[model samples]
Target: MKKALRWISKNLIKIYAFLGFTYLFIPIIYTFVFSFNKYVRSNLVWKSFTLENWKNPCKPIDICSALGNSIKIGLLATAGATLLGTLIAFALARYAFKGRGFVNTLIFLPMATPELVLGASLLTMFLNLGFNPGFWTIVIAHVMFCISFVVVTVKARIASLDPRLEQAAMDLYANEHETFRRVTLPLVAPGIAGGALLAFSLSFDDFIITNFNSGTTMTFPLYVYTHEKGGLPAQANVIGFSMFFLALLIVIAGQIVGRKRKVSA
Candidate 1:
């Protein structure tokens, strides 16, 4: 009994970790497997596997259009949010000015606010301003929320940087602009890239805010939501798997590049 108790206690954490990983990966596995499903209008069961689904990933016309919209909006929103947020982060981390505290507090408010509330409020404001909720409105809404996350992420990176690096650059007769361009920008670039990736992912995966702001615009998530009732097609799963693989490749490439740079240094 004592030996059995010891074994159980030793392996308990490993057991829990295995179960947790299993829980997370089951859906991903299901999606990847079903992407090869042979079906029409429903993919709830395994109806044999074929390469046709992968070949005809855009079989449904609307799905491709929705994916395009999602990609467009995500890219635009990420660019806008990353640029604005990087500026804000630099200001908060490097400057002391009037209303600094207030600005810092205000930036966090959007992140704290619920998505539903933010969406509804944005929708209401657009209506009041006589602006139609479409591509631009969705982009605006995504940027508004994404900027907060970007600011927080980049600000942390900025805050952790050593000011002595900039001081050394200036001591070498480099002006402020030159120092920022050569030294500061390079050092903080990883953080900016991380924040932009995060912003893009958040914008792409968002459903609630997009639903509220995307009037007559069908995003990938919205399409999935609507079609799930009728059973999602294998093409949808193909898109999901494709996105996962794309992201995986990007990450792997970044890691390889980082390793090479480190070895060269």
Candidate 2:
């Protein structure tokens, strides 16, 4: 009876997994399908299909501009956050420091808070300091959320590192800076790269914080939200489907590179 019940539980977990996957993917599939729709309604029927939306000509000019800004903000924020987070992680994971717990807690607090609350609080603080919520504000807000992820990822990487390398380097009369550059860094570089890529992905996809701090800024996600609220647009589906294709391509490219590396090894 116990074995039978265990078997039933395993089958039930598989069923639940399928249901969850379906729930997640159905909307994305629908969005991709309707990207080619002739009509812009929320629902897509068999009769509607067109490529005009994807191959569109534009006059409003905001989409292109917003795309540029989003890329800019993502790159800048990712770069800044990755650099700062890596430094902090190295310090924390390599050395015993005063107020380490307090500092770590403070560092992680932004990530734990709701995006809406973070955005609102930052907006208020920036406004109080006579800075407006706009492009740079959005970048800063993105950095706040993104940095914690980097710190956590890189800290784990550093924590897992062999301290013997540093000890050996010191025995060879290498300075702390030299040891860090030569020994500590190369070992953790892959993890840091992975973390930064992840941070870029998160910053790029963010909508809630972007929306609150954007002011006049129109990121792709914000653009989608705006058009979605106004009424559905064929162009929205086209953008979404494009993102899906881009994500798929990235996944495939990573797999190919990974396989090639394995073959090389």
Residue-by-residue lDDT tens digits, candidate 2, 84-107:
889888888878878998988988
- CA shift of 191, model 2, Å: 1.6
Q: TM-score winner among the candidates? A: 1
Q: Write the per-residue lDDT of candidate 1 for residues 1-265, one digit (tens) a residue.
A: 9999999899999989999999998999999999988886799988887999889889887999999999999999999999999999999899889998799788989988999999999999999999999989999999999998999999999988999999999999999999999999999998999999999999999999999999999999999998999888899999988998898899899999999998999
Clashing pairs in 2: none
Q: Model-by-model lDDT, in order? A: 0.93, 0.82
Off by over 4 Å in 2: 1-19, 40-47, 57-61, 164-178, 262-265
lDDT of 2: 0.82
Candidate 1 — which pairs collide? none
What does candidate 2 score on TM?
0.83
